[model samples]
Target chain A: MRKLIVVLTLCVISSLALVAQGTPLPDSTSDSTAQLLQQAHALYERLDLERAVPLLERVLSPGWSFGMTKAQRVDAYAYLGASLALVGSADSAARYFRAALERDPFTDLDPRRFTPGQVAVFRTARRQTFAVGARQVSALRFDPRTEQLSFTVVTTHGATLRVEVRSVDATPGQVLFQGESDGLREIAWNGLMADGRLAPPGRYEVRVDGRSRLLSRSDSTRVYFDVRHELPALEDTLHELLLSELRPERYPPSAATGDLVKGLGIAAGAFVISGALADGDLGSRSSALPATVAATAALSGVVAFVWRRHHAEAPENVLANARRRQERRLTNDAIQRRNNARIAQTILVIAPASGVGP
Target chain B: MRPAFAHASGPLVLLALAAGAPTAAGQWTVQGTGVLSVMRHRVDAGYGVEPSSGVLAGPEVAASLRDRLTVRLWTRSGSFHADGPGAIDRDVAEAGLQVDVAALRWLTVQAGTTRRTYLTVLARQPWTTVALGAEAHLPFTETGVTGIVRGAILPGVSVNGLGHPDLAIAVASGMEYRRGRASAAVLYSLERYRFAPSATATVERREQLAGLVVSVGWSLKR
Candidate 1:
């Protein structure tokens, strides 16, 4: 009876072990968190901040760590806070931003990174100041997109104001508004040409009617108005507006590894099949299989070799030769000395203009 | 004049202009660089300079919309020669799209399509390739609907289908020991295609090409 009991106990233990082995392991929260993070990043890159914010919040709530060091974590927090601010939730954004600052008190953080949208808000909120004076009717230009213009007027006031927007290219000779206030009356010109169309792209001028009242004398106020086109480069523009926002550090290298492994497995299988035919089989079947394998392997090898050679050699040779030629023309020491001299010359030239009173 | 007010207001005005003007979103920049290429074909007999040898010029343009999505367009024009005739000039254009999902920290799914004209000895041929792909630093290539798992024993991979009834699958894995400027990679790719018999050909052929590729790329952009 005792022997029977011992056997039963052993059987029970074995069954428990089998059951434990058969049951799959629990899913990892880290992986789910990472996936969520990736989705959020994609949404953010697509400019769907409305979608990204919620996804990021979800991932963050899971108490996830992207295998980052403490310093990196601090940086991540700051970026997260800034990103939130960009999507229009200023309060939450500010909270995250503060948290990031708290984590790294010594770092000189640029608040502008979090306030792209805020700049517009602030500008609109600021009090609108329109200049007052009897300005001359010399030239006028206006840009409706920027809601600004340039004008010239003959006024006695040394108080004549010139507003120049460097980022906009306004249409030339356009009139916008005409109005009055106090002893200081104003004429607002909605910059439009006589043809009822926006003026040609150039500098514009507006003449205020009451310039003489402020100046207390009639002096020609020469307002040189220049307009510049403020357009972002294609690459930068695309990156800002459409490219996915991915923090390269948060990505795992495992995906790349897994792909390599899968390919290796396929290659190994082929190699094994070819080896089996060569070693065990005989007659036409064996010979044909081996031959087929050898031919496929050789063709693949050639194609791969050609592709790599083309990709590497062509680009490298061109770049290397050019670099060598450039190097031959100027040694490192000589280049450094030349740069230093140029720097000195610039400093000397700018010093007088800076009113240092040499 | 107060220096503080002058300096403070200058940047403030600039910032206002940058923020308020929609025109600030579009601009053109010129990037000039020289590229010299040398290529040797394994199937072809001899090599001196590669078939395509010369300076390459291209216009690269990118645009951003709504602050999250970006589109990039690039056009390259150059000349290459076949063994028979005078050098033939060719033009190639490519466009790419990147979608950033905020949930994934390091992975941005990328899709690109490209068109090229092959000017050869016999005739000029046009080929268009479409690629719907995603790249992650992981090892497995996900396809169809199985791309959701973060650690499903499969790494992320890209699959591209060519216009010539050929399907290409490639998987790559590597480690960058010294901050990615220098690294080694092992890449494996499989291409399967059915080659139809041409007018001069005697047989129809179905072919599969599979191989391992080892590569190293240095970062020269910086």
Candidate 2:
């Protein structure tokens, strides 16, 4: 009796599922809700808001039949608003975002996405209080490439600052100081030696000093001097920056790729050994299989040769051209650097000594 | 239909394992909540609430290592409770890292590895909530080196790859006229992902998924 009941229950459940599947989807006329969402997504992906706004407005219309929860409605509003702002519709986007926030207060909506202009004002104000103490110094490293010398300074306050090309080793020496109000700075070198002539590509020492009156900081300074070489392109410089910023916990695979490769090799070896063991009759079959094996090998060789011939062709000719362009860009950048260094040297020589700041 | 439930059960067990684990501070955070689509379609009946779609919810945890370095781990599990054909659901997790090297006052360098569960683009998107399993970003990486420069021309670029059936490459570049609480950045991203042959029968029919996303954001804190 119990078995029969269980069987009946199963049958009923299966029948219900089948019925549900057979039932037609909600009517197309009632699909304005989904249509609105599709339109919004399409517009957002295309980076076009001009066409998406009116469609979204119609979908949000009160009479429109969309079976959406209050929360989902709020999300739609937020996304629509954000999309509008991205395409230069700030006022309208702000209104939508604010409306969404009112509907759903829990949303961690990023205000920054809505207001690009306001961010500049905020940063300027914070720059006024920018001051660093000696205790804030954590670590510092220097890198010199074919184009510029960069200094990476890590601070205890979770800030990483950089200084670029403070002085060139060549003639008519010029120094460039580049610093940010947010504890970041750089200095450039203009191909001039200390004696005011073109300097050789070699090592040089750089120094930085800072004092703030509001913080009552005097003589609280940190200094680092390191050897750096110039890089060929901005790409190379950027690559160096990425390598320096890799954190172990955040990017463990980057640090462990070597180990992973070794492990894969070991696993492959084990698979081969197991396959050999499984073919225990290999000794008996060797003589009989020699011809077959050779034929198979020959066939595989032919196939591989054909594949190689076809695969050897470049898949991306455009990419090859792009690479050539990149090389040219690098060359141009080097030339620019050299010319800038010469110009700086001329300025240094011609400028009045009294114009120098302390 | 029964098999789908069994397939869905596996992720549920994993979720139970994660939830049962002891909570740790700085190890977890309420990242955010949103809805994700199971598949892309032209027309449907409802709007906001997707009874047949998956409900996306999860936590994100970011921790610092040795002051200058930080690591972040996040997971999102979405499930749909519906009866009938085409009921869809999935769960995903990701981990990534960020490092800051201050060599100058104006530029800082950053680099790191990321697993499938931690792609930022998928996390930031409103629809398609499945955390891009194989997507990782080296946001400030140029060549193999990562660094930043301050003053005059503040330039940066990054290379990213998506894991899984679609091994895609994305290159991004950004410029910031940064000040204090108010800094504006214009970021441009281009991505290309190719689908596998085996994916023909599934919803992943497109041989390439290419798009561009440009975003500008600002923040204010008390």
Candidate 3:
């Protein structure tokens, strides 16, 4: 029984040693690739290249079932390169470094965690490989007047770089920077379109393209984000005036004929009153008196008809309509002024997005 | 004469009211008009007809509220002489107070009181009448011109030393042209009365008056 207990203790101690040294354990359903990367990274920190390299390679293998984040995968490749460089395999180390750089041009070797030889191998890989990258946008809010939206981009080597923020549909966009760039660069945008108006809110892409001066290779990268406006509500201008609001500028065709009829009616009324109501005993109603009114009425009728026919335009109505239109224009202009003021206070709200672009 | 002067006080009271017209609630308009009138007068009371013509001048005041209610006061005075050799010569004075209430956009119902006094070389005759009427306004499209027609019946008429007439009516037709606050108007008017034969006078009495009136007016609004 004593010998069996001693053998059990030895087995437990050997397992603990193997786990700490990052020795490949039996692949289990619960063992995630990220957990394996952490173990390998820990071994690499302790300068255990022999165990760390094999564990990192196994995590990156095609047969690995566990899912790993992009950051975790990049970490695995970087650790493999560092471990291989420490073991004096310079060519293999450079190959892994190039792979990591291709996945992420912003990848770098921490001088505190890596030796000069490992860092030199990473730098040599960067010179040989061409890659461009932009950091994923973090959630932020800024006013265009006093602050700006910031983006971080990188080139693997000295290269001509162009960084632009554009809508996903390829509408004309603003170029943040276009010049020779080396290493890491922070580009800023003032939330304006190429036409100097506030950038409309929608899904946008921050595209970075680079052409390496040291090599014939070129690379491009895209990072998508959603832009939304945080602003005061804007007012709408007045619509066109309705017909009832405006006076008719021209008289209808019936108006002239109607006036003629009205005048004739007046003449007939006078004649009826003089001839029918007047008593003959009152010495025969003065024909001159009644005739005076009838003639005046009939003449007025003729004159009105001729005047209305020749003058089709109603000047009073034209003036009234013009005044109404001017009043409407003034009202709409006031509304537009208020809307522009509200838009000037707009705040750009930016957040990371996916599934937007090719 | 004292009673006739007292009867003329009705239009004076209306004129005072128009001068101090209330304008606190709705739109108010006040108009002042200068009137010139030409009249032909005749009378037949069991005798030969007497005919005469006269010219009169007067002032008229009107106050309107909300284009809905209106009050008017007017007075005219002149002398009539024989136009034919029928022996008619008298001095005439008349005053009236009228109120118009709009029943529709283009129609108004009116009530008024009129007092007319005739003075001959021997005596004075006074006639008091109450009238109910309707007026129609026809506006010419966009021309600032309006045609007016008015008819009224004298339901209550009283004259000293005379019986009430069996039939009495008045009618007028006119045209008005308005530009801004200034306006000019020309109107033809007629009044007729027929009285039944009475015990004191054996024959029916008939009287008629016809005239043309022209007025110019200025308006103020608040």
Candidate 4:
């Protein structure tokens, strides 16, 4: 009887102790709130917001330590708040907004989206939020005479800035510059791809992404592109000019040749007329002079015909067609360059809701 | 019966006037010709007859109607020293009309009427002649050297309104040197005449008239 009572008491205490373990476990082996938050995000992306809300709530539940970085925590609460709001529980969403700002005082939402009025309840919570803004990389210009191209980026206070210069076409070129810098960052590019060859004339994009560590929830990024056209060398230009002159168009047979044909015809006709007038009486004299003049005319006519045949206009047409093909190729390249120059980007600002005002 | 000279001369004048018009093909052409000929008459032509050897100067006008046909008008006048029995000073006028039809590129058929009238002694006795002929041209590729042949049959001869079966013929062969619109040719032609017995002349008279005609011609077009 005594042994039985002791065993039963031991079992009861063990049951009570296990019940006293305050935090909830996701499952038997883990209480990782980050994994739970990731699962909830997947559910939210899948449009199962109702299911995602419960998972997000579990991450914020009492006695559960969601060991996430400052950025990660802001992201989690923002995801939960957004999911709760999507599920039509604005009141429940407001609590997560307040809790996010308690972690990072300058917390804000993506300004372009989720306007402050959308979460008016969080607007009162964000009294001490930090400002977030970005500057165009083109503010830092390179010297015109130098081969190197330099640029700079400016971010908000205590911000982490990353700048990159990449080809606008995005596929054929290598990263010309990529690095992290302080709130005020400066970079130089040698105008060459990773292959060490001088970059061809083309469009290139400069991108800057920034986040202030002092205020994890406020972040901004800017992207824009520029076009460069490299002029040809003098030797190349001269060579092309000479090459164009090499195959001269001789057809449409020049005006001088046409005049030659007309003049020859006239001379032949004059010989024929002269022969006619020089004809004499047939008594004792033979008519040899007229025959000689006729012979001169016949020979002249033959020469004129030969000249007309050799100077025909077909070769000029062939050269013209070749020139047209070259023009089309140049026009197509210009259009491609114009299209690249039209590259567009929208500035992105990333933030989340903040805490309620004290 | 009308005089044969009047019959032949009327057609000649008509041809001469018709050639004065032009055509639309731009191919209408007129040709002026000068011919100097030497002639020999076969028999003595009685009173005031021409000499055995005589010179005939003829001037002609010819027009080709497009490329297919040609019409020519000619007049010849001659003066001869009388040399036969009871001869006297004499003159003769000959007028003629000739038409040529191009039967082929190489061949042409011709017909003409000619009348010869004595101006002095035998003025009342005018002789008329009718001719049918064909000409062939053999052209060389050189466009200058050409061989020509002509033959004619004279079916009848008329004098003072009377017709005679004279069995007369004419033939010629020549070489020509030609250029576009211009040519020169020299040919020898033989014309034969035969007359039946008459009240005043008992035996038949056969006369062979032979001549070398030198001709130069030019084409004018509108």
Which stretches in model 1 have alpha-carbon errors above 4 Å?
Answer: A1-358, B1-59, B62-68, B77-103, B137-164, B169-222
In order of TM-score, best first, we have 3, 4, 1, 2
The prediction achieving the highest DockQ against the true structure is 3
lDDT of 2 by residue, B1-222 (tens): 121222343443343334334435443321111112121111111121111322333333333333333343333344334323432232323223333443333333444443322112223211111212121222221111111111111122121221243433333222232233233322222223333334223333221111111122222221
What are the chain A TM-scores for all the models, listed individually? 0.22, 0.24, 0.83, 0.30
Q: Which tens-of-lDDT digit does each residue in A258-307 have in candidate 1?
A: 43444444344344433431212111112232233334333334443444
> Residues A132-233, candidate 4, lDDT per residue (tens digit)?
333333433232335455555554345555555555565455443334443344566665566764444445555555555556654544345454443422
Q: Tell me the tens digit of each residue's lDDT in model 2 across A1-358.
A: 9999999998677556535655223244656566556656555554556556665676667876668777667767766776666665666666666565445433334455535543332222222233332211222322322233333332212222333222323333333443332333333454444565544433333333434333433222333232223333322222222333332223222323332332233223223322332222211212211232223323333433444344443324335455655776787788677766544333211111111121
TM-score chain B for all models.
0.39, 0.29, 0.89, 0.78
Query: What is the C-alpha lDDT profile of model 3 across A215-316, one tens digit per residue?
Result: 998899999998899999988888898998888888887878888888887777777777886677788666666666666766677778888898878888
Indicate the worst ten consecutive residues by lDDT in candidate 4 chain A: A344-353
TM-scores, all candidates, are 0.22, 0.17, 0.80, 0.36
Which ranges in model 3 have alpha carbons more than 4 Å from their true place?
A1-27, A42-50, A85-91, A111-120, A139-141, A226-257, A278-283, A346-351, A355-358, B1-27, B40-56, B65-69, B78-106, B109-132, B153-168, B192-209
State residue A334's C-alpha deviation in candidate 3, in Å. Answer: 3.7
Candidate 1 chain A, which ten residues in sequence have the lowest lDDT sum? A347-356
Error of 3 at B22 (Å): 14
**Residue A350 error for model 2, in Å?**
52
Top-scoring candidate (lDDT): 3
B1-222: candidate 1 lDDT, tens digit per residue = 111211332333333223323444344211121112221111111122122222223333333344234354444434433322332333222222223332244354445554444344545544344444444432222221011111111122221221233223222222211123332333222223332444443344332222333333222111
